[model samples]
Target: MASNGVEKVGVLIVGSGPTGLGAATRLNQLGHPNWLLVDKEADAGGLACTDVTPEGFLFDMGGHVIFSHYQYFDDLLDTAVGQGDAAWNTLERVSYVWLKDRWVAYPFQNNISALDKEDQIKCLAGVVDAKVANAVAQGKPKNFDEWIMRVMGPGIADLFMRPYNFKVWAVPTTMMQCDWLGERVATVDVDRAIANVINNKEDAGWGPNAVFRFPLEGGTGGIWKKVAKLLPPERQRYGCQLAGLDKDKQVATFADGRQVAYDALISTIPLDITLRWLGQSEWADGLQHSSSHIIGFGIRGRCPHGLKCWLYFPEDNCPFYRVTVFSHYAKKNCPADGTKLPTLCKADGSGPDSSEAAEGPYWSLMFEVSESNYKPVAQQPTKLGGSAVAAQGTWPAVVAETLAGALATQLMQPGDEVVSVYHRRLEHGYPTPSLGRDGVLKQALPWLRKHNIWSRGRFGSYKYEVANQDHSLMLGVECVDNILFGTQELTLEHPNIVNPRKNLEMKYTREPVMPGLLASAKPMSAQEN
Candidate 1:
């Protein structure tokens, strides 16, 4: 990379995630050149990247959907992927929860009509009770469990909310705080529920991501790789992991002995790992997360369901909490229609391992299993992009169980041939909003900022509410603004304010007043919070 000596820059951005790219993109747009972005991985997108099977099928890390709340983010995406139908596949979000031997509409509380008569009655009663309780509920929920009870009542909570969330987070609802519950969970309307139940209707449109867009090719990774291409090539360095840090001297050493010192530092790495590199692991006491096992099954057949983009399974029958009908998103997700591949094994792994060549019209399903200290996955799924069946090592039959789970949940038939399989264990997937999270962040973030180091991203800030790509990008954008000028970081400091409203002031035009970024002289409403 760079020469042996330490190369000093005005600003050094670490980790080529959306957050880091946000800062770098802003700097480049401002025509500032005294900055560099470095990432250990060969590619950008971090956890947002897509991996390909040897058989030519593609699977993104997990189920990722773009739902923006900012005009700047929309502009950023359009600039990267090029605007219009040619660059994006804007599809309807046809999501269902596999429960009670049927595909029920999403936001289980709102679509009680899809359940059996008895269960529908129970859910409707719970919704009515929750409405009454919330009318007089004092203060805020003590925890996510309490919030669930107050919002949807115990029936929906026990059947769906509790079990589904536990599967996703691998953390008990009692231990999670409700402050991060702004636009995440759908709110149930008692009147709408009763009407839908009586009329046999489904209320599927409940959240912002009810409909989203994905890339037509290369999956989600295409977006970030394009964004990375937009920046000056000289300033971006890959394959250089941050080995250690000296906060006092503002110096960072890479794995290759290359070093960079900067007046201001922006790190998008996870806070816990960053602290470990800084040799202050004790400050990460409140940080906790669940590892994600992304399993993909590339099969040779037409999908039983049509236009069902993603499905959620809260029942114990499936090891995965959610499964995305990946091939439905884009034709490129699977191999070419006439391409031939071997039938490795059946989904249930019942047959003797065979290498019979097969042809396809292929469809794939991507699954996510959560693993944490509290609730662990049955096995550590094998690394992604390996052989379909050979990657299933001695670690408890994860691929086999996942296949069985899929059959039990009717995601696949008993004889569905597994043509291509892929698995990846992301060490830090979801950042848990534990009760003690605020206490640890208040202590750790300020300490890093005091050393002129700004840490911001999905795992960097450790706030799931602001952990989506758009929010993560804004965290970097605002953090740089905070560094350059004394601007307030609205996305980081106040998620509730940003989540609901449309923030449209940043057009990335014109210059600011002296000493600060009023860029465009058209002020962004950063002080709204």
Candidate 2:
């Protein structure tokens, strides 16, 4: 505590998710002792947390896979948890698109050979038109829709790109900007695509997460929980809801009347909310975000999906845009085969044959439904006529809808016994890359930094392209380095440079000698530490 009767630290970190944890980890490793980490939740891992049902089924907040682009991030994971085969499960990505009532190999544009002959011709014709147009193209695309047409043409745009993106973002593609998309969306390679079509082959190997690792014991949240454990317990404070931030005084007041004064602050709170707190609410209008409704079902059956990880849904047959066979990630994700649980309802939303608990050779599916102003969701009422609604009486309408959708998509059979159900609504699910996002960020981030505040995370900086776990963590790590040594924040500034290639410059023990020195810095030798 400071002499002025306010708690004080060299740095005060808000939100103990990957961003805060990364900042804390780097500070601790650098022997910096005067920093404190706080989070509103009782546990860490903000959007990356996991929830376990009463029947012991585990579902992550959303589909999360680790496809790291930095060696420093890999080092942190290895340091937090063991790197051996026992600690992790390296799985091949067997992802597909649920289209025309059939499973098409992922990167739909490249796998048009699976489509009907007439549809395949449409796709091929569009690709030919797109290539011809590109040879003498004009200025850059006006928006995301234009970018799509420029890259893959109208056939794919109408069939998959437009509809699929609208379902995922809950907004029209015209409202989105194209600059944020570098390697995020797969573009067609005309020659290869044509060759594959002629050969009647599938091109399933496209994205960065084609091969990724997951923690064997815990869900995605378990990884962050382990990372938090690496930090000193005394340095982390939970249940500290931030009430106000005084930029002038460099002090943060909690909801409970506690105050923490700091020389610098690293905030992972959503940028819109942060702007509201700073009395700059008007600037928040430039940012657009979509809320997520995640629904999970634990079923009693052998895994029917086999090695399939996730499937995309673009049609209106399902409310969700994506569903993942979450149990396929780890054996511990589902309850033991002998564990018993009752069936809440059938896949068709009908009553089960028996209400009695049954044993499960279990599997689980998690679905993500996007919601925005353009797409509103039907939420169950908390109270009506001054009385609280019963859980059974007021079942979430979305859950029932999702059950029907699962059947419609053939994800669940007619009478598959559902053992457990989980649904969570994340208000700030995805930070959308809207047309005006960059303009707002350019002004707001620098203005906050002038007040000794560094806002960088998934929702913090609002860059969806670099909002993965590894990218989020590195944002914090880079922000800390910028504060301490005036180093360039490549991840924050030039996402294009840091994203497409592996960054091996910053190892765990290696320390930079000067500011603006990344490429010149050498990794510390094995015996240095």
Candidate 3:
């Protein structure tokens, strides 16, 4: 390790995310020691990290659940987070959509049984049109809005698809492209909808994540923290402020007057930031993204949110599009038994005004609200306390609306006491699959590759379809193979191939490890040591 000066390496990875960690892990397995990994965070889970409030409420960036298709990814999870049964909670996904003041088992189009007769008629008619259109329609969908109509028809689009998607993406369907939809969005089946509605049956098992697992203790962040540990300690650097990148000189300079030169560079940072560093910001001008506000509540009451894992809101009553019953996932999500925390406020904005603390058998709720050019959140948080209320929650004036929204949406009753309020704003949450995304990625990505730099991750690659933690991880693994042995990056180059089929290119199966024997055996990442 070069002490007081520049260091040169065979490969240099910027950002300690799944992508960076995946690359570092692969290189390590390949017996390559001349690689270095650096990140700005003190921790390894970039957007994947978890946060705890002063009152001991745990909140993730958003709701993250793992549904792996790659054996390589499955093996990495075991090596990091571990194969121990105590490390995770295997879950049966119980998701529902809030529509017309009733909870419909999710994939709204398929569960018309829960809808009113009027809605059922409307949706079924639309499905009929879609089936007819599918047979005769030519070329590809011009945009997401057209695609929705072509596949789901006008009735479903008007009643739920259009509004719910707009809330989640913070962009109208008309502005996005349909190519990234792959397995992410469910396609409406005409026969299934008709049968479910007529027979009064529910169809919830539609996607790959029909069953999933989450870390037993920490949120989704726990998995990445483990993977970042499998590299040489001395080569991993954390808390280093990245100043600039001189692409021409093949150098990365830190704010503290240190530099590293690399034969090949792998960046997991957002493409816009990377381009800006390389002094070519214009190439990424067409990119669009939505910001996210994670509003969490630690409550002191009977948990009204039952075994349902998460719920979606399409009505205007709530500021959030989705709310996860966080406490149901793990006991450690909230403060332990009898641990006292000051009551922040009630769900109805009533409270213990002073610094008065109380004990709990607590439960929590985590909400996600999206913002974009069309939908905006406040730049500055409004200075409001327990007695204050906003007319309707808009961005910036968050707290009052969030609380009121909870009450309005019936997630919380008027008497539900709020023990803790946790709010976090993430500037770049979801990468919009906009109509112009492919054009921009095509031009920018190939040019970067020409310079021996591979941008591959959520924002690095700028492909939302392949932006999950697993996909991001494989992008790094594949990029390394492409760098060293010229392997095809099936994950990055073809998301369609990897998203549906279980990629058994690499496979490992293990029986669940016994719990309690190693419950406290937490492995430290390379930098932590």
TM, every model: 0.92, 0.94, 0.91
Clash tally, candidates in order? 2, 0, 3
In model 3, how large is the Cα lDDT of residue 174?
98
lDDT of 3 by residue, 197-300 (tens): 88999999777777888888878877788777666778789998678888877888987888998889999888988887777778667788899999888898
Worst 10 residues of 1 by lDDT: 507-516
Candidate 2 TM-score versus the reference: 0.94
**Alpha-carbon RMSD to native, per candidate:** 4.0, 4.3, 5.8
The prediction achieving the highest lDDT against the true structure is 2
Give all candidates' CA lDDT scores.
Answer: 0.83, 0.85, 0.80
Candidate 1 vs. true structure, TM-score: 0.92
lDDT by residue for model 1 (1-529), tens: 3375679898899988899998888787666759999999998888788899898989888898776776677777888888778988998899899998998988777888988898887788887898899999999999999999999888899889999999999999999999998878888878888999889998886777877898888888889998898887899999889888899999998889878888999998899888887777777766888899898989998877799988999989878999999999999999997998877767666442556666778999999999999987766444222334553333345666788888899888867777787878899989999999888899899999999999899999999999988888878878877887777788899887788733423222223222223242133443211
Could you say which candidate leads in TM-score? 2
Clashing residue pairs in candidate 1, if any?
A: 341-358, 510-520
lDDT of 2 by residue, 30-91 (tens): 76769999999999899999999888999998999887777677778877777879799999
